[model samples]
Target: MALRVTFVLPVFPRAPVGGFRVVYEHANRLTALGCQVTVVHERWREGWSRPLRHLREAARDHRHRRAPHRAIDWLPVDPRVRLLIVPALTPAHLPSGDVVVATHWKTATLLPYLTPAHGSPVHLVQGYETWNVPDPAPVHQALRLPFPKITVSTHLTRVLSDLGVHSGQITTVPNGLDRTTYRPPPTGAPRAGVAFLLSDSAAKDSRTALAALHQVRAHHPALLARAFGVAPRPRDLPPWIHYAQGLTGEDLAAQVYRPSAVFLCSSTTEGWGFPAAEAMACGTAVVSTRNGGVEDFCHHNQNALLVEVGNPTAMANAIRRLLDDEPLRTRLSTAGLATTATMDWQQSTAALLTALKAIS
Candidate 1:
């Protein structure tokens, strides 16, 4: 019999999100491999305990459940993949399968309540996602749940182990790059801009990256700085910084990553640093902070330059070095492309499947 797999997500995203993207990737691939795969989205998960918010969300969830197609139009989900939108993640809302995977700490809370027919429960730890809650203790406690855990990086594996999740229970399956869409621009294409992602989240440290760009501008007044995000361009961003709002897939590759000579990853922390990996796959040199997410694929001075977290001056200098030294930039870009080439989706999905099957 084909393995039956079910993935429970916190909510359906209206915009692009890295953690959610990973889950979709696996869902599509697992379905292709002949598994009976179903992805469940809770239409009414408020993630907190406010009565007013609950009432507001309850109304919004009703609207979403009726028009879920509008929310997922931006993503390219495989036709064979089964999508289920439920009011909540309780066992009563879930379908029985050989394995049920929790894609977030909040969703993991449902695993303990599920019976065997819902499949052996598994947790997919994409990040140390403590920022969402006021108390990180619950997040840590979820890691200790007696279920197999799949983490995106070795750093996350160590995090789980430190929290008493046995080493034997954690599997490290790095996120993969789709080379067909995220490859180097056609030979002789313009690779002359520096790029970074804009975000409202403090952990992403967009202020540090923006400050570094300003410093780089002091030396190279005509430097082209490009930024993109799902959110509208901030009014305060300098008029010179070209912002592309909400670009994805081929358009994101052709317009943002391919034109850039360098990509900046200034996040203080990440589970897998998706944009940096995508930029590298586009053969763009990278100057990143020592964010744990990039550690699995980035090597300082080998594939990319790494600096400390929250230091604008150091980030500025590193960007200057790449802009001034053409050969060094070329070397790093070449190396980055080579490094990211190994992160194949087939391999990552296979590893995830193996872990799920073992637990099942």
Candidate 2:
């Protein structure tokens, strides 16, 4: 019989963000293997009066797709694959399946309280969403008991270990890139000097980067700054910064690193520093704060220039270094490309499949 799996993510089918993309890729890959997946996630609620045209555009492409008659957008899910709409705040019940993976802390707790209980529940930890939840003790205790942990970074692996999870019980699953899409554009336009890793999130620290860039632009008059995946309304942003929201696949890969001389990520933490790796692959030097697992992939003053987190002066200085020094930028960029070779989604899926098989 085909393997049956259920993924409990807080939001699915609605949000078109990086996390959603990761989940989708893994789901599609697994489905190709005669496995079935049920995704339990939150519905998207659009507050603005944007284009229903785009919603219709998306729905037309997918057969099981449902467009919001009121204010929701649902994916055209496969019959074999199920999409369960669950409340954002409530804990979910794990349906019987060969595997049940709860993506965040809220859903992770559900595994411990299963109707008949479960085998080892797969808990995928990205960042401190585990730490930020109401009370982590239940999840922590479960991790020590029946939960086999799957993390995306050495940093997260270490953090979970600190929380009493056995090192052996946990395996590191790094993120990957689609090289064909994100590779450098053939025209090779003059590098877009100003770039951001993402500033809006708690880790990204948008205010600090914005203030520092305001200072940097005065010196480099022609400098143009672009925020990736931060501001939804691109036009509403201050005229100084350029806005490119929701660019993924090959286009996101190409624009973020390929032509940009320097890519910036101000986040003090990450499960894996995906933007840094992607940028490096595109031959773009990275200027990131000394936060999270960036060091795992980046060497300061070597392949990537690392600044102290929240230090606008240091961030501006690092960007200046890349700006004035082309050889250093080339060196970092080339090194970044070399780093991307080792990490691929195949590694993550293989490990995940192993864990899923064990669950049954």
Candidate 3:
């Protein structure tokens, strides 16, 4: 018999952000594997005026069609995967299943109130999300809960262990890349330039990336700079920097990673830095700070160059070294390709299923 798996999500299904993408991929792949999967999402927020909210949702849907980055475009269509939209996440509103997953801290806190009739609760710890919220104590307490845990990286595994979770209670499943979509371009060498992600989040630290690029430009006056993100292009970005907003997965591979010589990441933290791995898979060398979770694959002076976070000068120096030394760049690029080759999504998904089966 197939296991009935349900994921309790805090937000309405939308564009695949780093965290949400993982949830979407798991739900989609599990359905393909013949599991009966259900994704439960909130349909409306409490205290919102229904008429006004409807109008706003209509406008947002129109905008999403024009630029999908504004919202989610890829949702599972398999008949085995069902979407249940409810008013809220109270115990009465959740559905019963063979296995139920709490995808975020808020949901994890509710697990104790639920019984096995709601299925066994599994905490999918994507990251140390307390950093983004105003009150972290609740999230911290949730970490110590007795639920079985699955972390996306070793950094998170360590974080949970530090929180006093027993090693036997947690499993680490690293993220994977779609090699067919991210492979190196078929032709000439990558163009001389640097590519990075742009975002408004404080943790992303896009300003530091800009500062680093500015420092590099002082030496290589004509060095190319490119950036892409889900958000619309910012007004303050330098005019010479090529910026593309709302690029799809295929567009990101073709327009940004495939042609860039180096991928620069300056994030203060990450569950798993997907862009860095994707760029590396496309044969672009990576220069990044010691962002958490990226440590899973980024080996300094091996597959990529690492620097201290929040230091523009160090980031600039690393970018320049890569630009000046063709041999070093080539070595890192080759090693990065090899690293990604081993990280197949099929393998990663199989590991996740194995864990879920044990729970069932």
Candidate 4:
């Protein structure tokens, strides 16, 4: 009989973020590997969204939050895959399988109960979401579920151990990207300006990126910066950098990645560093700090321009290097694409499958 796998992320079936995207990739890819897979999640936040501002829209229409048409049910899933979408109030209902993978901290806590085996549930940790955030209801509350103990990074694995989880119980398995779908933007596209992405997600430390932007524009007065995700308020930073809120898929590719000179990451911490990987794959030289998994995918001189964490001056200098040295940027961009080939979704997916099998 084919091995059965259940990948549970209680928060999913929602919008596309790093974790959501990773879960979907695994769902499809695991099926290709001949494992029967079931994905259980709640696609929308619904009535539970504590943020009043966000609630009105999710309540007005399920489609009001993000790409409303981009619901999980409508996607073409693999024949061997089953997807379950539940509302917020409903408890995750399931039993043990050959393998149970939990993507979030809360989901991991629930995994032991979701399935029969409490001792060996896989925790797909991403970063210091625990260290940086205030209310770690999902992660800490889930850690109570007996972390299946697998992580997405060494830092995360260590974090779990520090939190009283057994070191041997947590395995590090980083997230991988599909370099094939992510292609370099054509050189022919008219360059509108330099592009930067921002999300308030605490781990993103977008404020650090903003701080660097202040120094960048000051030194190079002609430099123009454009952005995405929720625009920072007046208190966030200076007015020189442009912000466009959020973008995704092809629109993100054309509008944000195409004409951008270099991709920037000023994160204070990370688990897998999703934006850094995507930027490199799109052939944009990345100027980022050596935060988290950037070390795994980026080679300081070879693939990216990495700065010391928390140093805006170094960050600005790195960006200035990309702006001034075309050859260097091209070299980093070209090398970055080559680096991504080795660390594609295939690599991380293979490790995840192996970990599942090991526990099984």
- The lDDT of each candidate is 0.89, 0.68, 0.84, 0.69
Candidates in order: C-alpha RMSD to true structure = 2.1, 5.3, 3.2, 4.2
lDDT of 3 by residue, 1-360 (tens): 888888887866444477777777787788888888887766545344687877676555445434333345543345455766566687888878888888888888888988778888899888888666889888889989998999999999998998899999999988767888888987675467999999888888999999999999999999888899877789888887899887757788899998899999999988788889899999999998898888889999999999999999999999999999999999999999999999877778788889988876
> Local error of candidate 1 at 255, Å?
1.1
Tens-digit per-residue lDDT, 1-360, candidate 4 = 666887776654433467777777777888888888877665456445467845754453445224322455423456556766555412345434677777766565555454354224566776556755577766665664554567776767666777787776777777777565566866654443466767676666677777787788787787778687644444554466666544665556666765678888887777777777877887888988888667778878898988888887888889988888988988998899898777667777788888888887
Q: Could you tell me every candidate's TM-score relative to the true structure? A: 0.95, 0.82, 0.92, 0.80
Cα displacement (angstroms), candidate 2, residue 29, comes to 1.1
User: Which model is ahead, 3 or 4, in terms of lDDT?
Assistant: 3
Give per-residue CA lDDT, model 2, range 308-334, as digits (tens). 889998889889889988888878877
Given candidate 3, what's the lDDT at residue 134? 88
2 versus 3: better TM-score goes to: 3
Candidate 4 C-alpha error for residue 157, in Å = 3.5
Off by over 4 Å in 3: 44-71, 74-79
- Order of models, best lDDT first: 1, 3, 4, 2
Candidate 1: residue pairs that collide: none
Backbone clash pairs for candidate 3 read 14-72, 15-72
Q: Which whole-number lDDT from 0 to 100 does residue 89 have in model 3?
A: 82
Pick the winner on TM-score between candidates 1 and 2: 1
- 1 or 3: which has the higher TM-score? 1
Residue 262 CA displacement from its true place in model 3, Å = 0.5
| Candidates 2 and 4 compared by TM-score, better number | 2
User: Tens digit of lDDT per residue, candidate 1, span 319-348?
Assistant: 999989999999999999889889899999
